[model samples]
Target: MVTIIKGKDRAEYPEFFTQLFKLRYKVFVEGRGWSLPTKHGLEIDQYDDDEAIYFLDVNEHGIIEGTVRITPTVQSSLTADYFSHLIENGQSPRSSRVYEATRYIVRPSQKSRDLNRAAKSRLLAALTQWCLENDVESIQTVIDSNTLPTFLELNPKVLPMGLSYPYGGGRNTHGGGDCMAIRWPISQEILECVRLYGDLSLLHAVDAISSENIGEMIH
Candidate 1:
């Protein structure tokens, strides 16, 4: 079954963060060829250590299936660090209702008839629950284009919130990946999608939510 984890509580979380890193390394770095820093193959960034919240899925065997990263919109420098152009061009919204979703990754082993869908749906449910309890109005994520239609198809309520833009590159980064910001309601559809597809990788969902429904979605 899937589980929701928060903060650094070890007894409840145990080695979850470690498992999370291992899965991240295998997928984001080795499996997907993302140019994340290497040393142990795990992909970690400054964002991982910040005021971010994580939603994790673990299988019956205690293996991590997938993970999603959420951060306060105000804490993220999306307007200043990456999507400045989108903001300056009046393509992105600046609102307190929004939160940023990032660094999503999932293990391939979770792919299955039931598990995939369940994991994804659960993740969305957890996020929506957090939003409702915290009085959050919207969720913003820098996601892929291919997954756009899936997000719309899966949950029509998460309206597109920003312009699309290319992601990762240059001397210290990977290439060709693109992402966009989409907003989710505090409840309702967001919870339903999570209830259905929580087992599916948030990375895949994010990518699926981006690609206009063409290729296989991966984060």
Candidate 2:
């Protein structure tokens, strides 16, 4: 069972952020042996704020199992922040109906399902639902070389968008685990397929933004 939460304003979903970080810490740091200085035992960065919509997967016990962040890749968020040297033209913030996906983490407590095809399908479904409601047409993801196959397995439509190289010692790649940039088209039908495999929610913008309250709405 997976629980999905969409982040709202800064004040409304504070607990969600906390849980998100806790989940990150468990997956990226403690579970995966990622040696990063995670303050409060959670992995968080400056990019997380009111504008970012968080997709959280929690278990039946309400414990966060996996999580990811999706934010508008407009001019405000230049790809330079994460991968500047790789792109020669330099990343410009664009509101061209694009959404950047990053910070994908799965807790150690839930590793049993990471390789499960059905679970992955459902996760994709929830993501598509959100994109449809928000009118997001383009979606982007950074993949580690080895993990590229995993995303590719999700569908043949997945495509590499920009430069590919080792990221964070290539921990994300399936081989060296070097990260690669990838993108794919998001459609209502495809997202619907994602929901079929797992649980999903279409969060309200106001509630998604509120840091004090974390919630989910089924689309």
Candidate 3:
């Protein structure tokens, strides 16, 4: 199930971050080769301040499967602070209605590649649910070509905001290839799209409920 952990409540769950940050270290630091500020096998960045909220999809055992980070544009965001040049004419998302989504990662423990990918779909669905719950108007993020396909699938007409540029080591793209900043309009349609494409059985507890036993929520 997806667990909602806002910045304020983060301190309440130390073990959660321990597992989640280790996953981030594996995915972003070791795997993707992003030069993030990582130490003690924890991928912690400045953007992980109180302004950020984390959506984590964990198994019934509390093991993190995948996670996403949403930073309010009204405060500091990945786009506004660092990747502004990727925005058209430097007009990054800065209003409260818009949010910046980042740090999407799926744990590599899944031996089945197909199951791992399907779990990522569930993570996307969870992120969409968060946007819907928070009344978010638009969601912006920086991603490389590797993730463009999934975003395209989630938003049928998804497109880049401006020309692609190099960032702190793009993911899965060749030689840290061009990373694009994208914005998607938030609406019920997004939730519908996720429902249409995500693993429906994993939809339980992505938004309102964060049951310790996801199996219980499924039925």
| Maximum-lDDT candidate | 3
Model 3 — which ten-residue stretch has the worst lDDT? Answer: 199-208
**Model 2 misplaced stretches (Cα beyond 4 Å):** 1-10, 13-15, 31-37, 75-78, 87-93, 107-115, 169-176, 192-219
lDDT of 2 by residue, 76-192 (tens): 243546665454334443556888877776543534543454456655666777788888876876666677776754555676756676655675433245656667678765665
Model 3 misplaced regions, further than 4 Å: 108-114, 168-175, 199-219
- Candidate 1, which segments miss by more than 4 Å at Cα? 8-14, 77-80, 87-95, 106-110, 168-175, 193-219
Q: How high a TM-score does candidate 2 get? A: 0.71
Ranking by lDDT: 3, 1, 2
Which prediction has more favorable lDDT, 1 or 2? Answer: 1
lDDT tens digits, residue span 145-196, model 1: 6778866755777666556767665223554466666666677656665555
Q: What lDDT does candidate 3 reach at residue 45?
A: 90
What TM-score does prediction 1 earn?
0.72
